[model samples]
Target: MSRRKVGLWYRLAAALTRPPMMMLFRRDWRGRHHIPATGGFMVVVNHNSSLDPVAYGHYQYSTGRVPRFLAKSSLFTNGAVGAMLRRTGQIPVPRGTKDVRDALKAAVSAVNGGEGVVFYPEGTLTRDPDLWPMAGRTGAARVALRTRCPVIPVAQWGAHRVLPPYQKKPRIFPRTTHQVLAGPALDLSSYYGRAVTPALLGEVTDVFMGAITDLLAEIRGEPAPAIRQRTGREHPHGLPSVSGRS
Candidate 1:
């Protein structure tokens, strides 16, 4: 399918999905104005629960932007779900591989076509049980560098509290409240047009992760675990640095 058709289908799906989602979470989104009214961009948000994408999707739809999410291939198993994802312009990524050339090309094309792409740099929901963002991976950085699009850091809290991770069921009697905060866009011009060295990539990833951590802290009313302090190194994946950097 063409990008135009995919985006149209995504918009329709989002419209249909948003209303019930709003009712389910009784969502209260703030700083939505921070999202640009028009343009290509990437939204890098912290992951806490499986519902994070749904919450963010609803929020993006409310802001008049149809979101294209990068999801794991496992979630696309169901025929209906896979069809919906395809119609909605979501990309499925194969895990545990460096072979993202195809996914990267698709992402770059989407951004260049003026679509909004949302991804979780952590790659999985937070395992800390407190829902704080874990150290980030570098996939988001690579995309950001490739597209040179504005990267908006979104901090989401209370979703995990709504439906905690590793639980088999969710509580539906009393709807949970969710808060979505959209922060300012990150600047990556310093490394643009240059070879993305390990140090440069780590620096860019830290910049994005720091913003996400700050937003999580704001929502939870407590500081998130410091990345450098806890791990003693940048980035969870430990991507090696090239010569003369890091």
Candidate 2:
């Protein structure tokens, strides 16, 4: 594919991020063709370490698509990091507030206008002791249902080795392997025009989370547990009920 129209800020951010990513991790990306070639779509990815987004973003950028992520509101505070995020089309979500729904509205608009948005369905890094994907909230389902965009489930592993959750020190010497996998756009037309009830959202959320867990299992060459580990702070339509988790 010849160069797709990616923004300068995205290019700059990738440039700034690539060296550190290169020095720290080896990438194993798969099933990228599952991503829509040229249209708006939603990617439901499991979150573990913060570093995984960089790996995931690299995978997206390499495929010639600049991902629009649902970023935490704090990253948008007035500053250079904030400026870079805004210029690159990331959506700032005031995660715990009632107004978090506004971020959903913005995502819907962007998808309808042909942009790929990435959603970390669990809203934060895994609280599962083993880093398995936890129960996800309804935002991913809400966005897909509202915009009727293709929801592609992406599963990733290995970035946590570079920087695990709840820890400040990163292991950079051994060169962690950041594995990412994407699957075909899920067929959710069955739920397209249904009422956006909690039950409906829950069902769709299951599909998204289930697919991610399956992918993570594949990457690790193991079986996902019948019951996903839960952090016990599930948010119906928002971030974690616990403060300072994301």
Root-mean-square deviation of Cα positions for candidate 1 versus the true structure, in angstroms:
7.4
Candidate 1 runs further than 4 Å off: 1-8, 228-246
lDDT of 2 at 235: 30
State candidate 2's TM-score: 0.90
Task: Report lDDT per candidate.
Answer: 0.75, 0.83
Q: List the residue pairs that clash in candidate 1.
A: none
Error in Å for residue 237 of model 1: 20
Candidate 1 minimal-lDDT segment of 10 residues: 237-246
Per-candidate clash tally: 0, 0
Error of 1 at 56 (Å): 0.8
The collision pairs in model 2 are: none
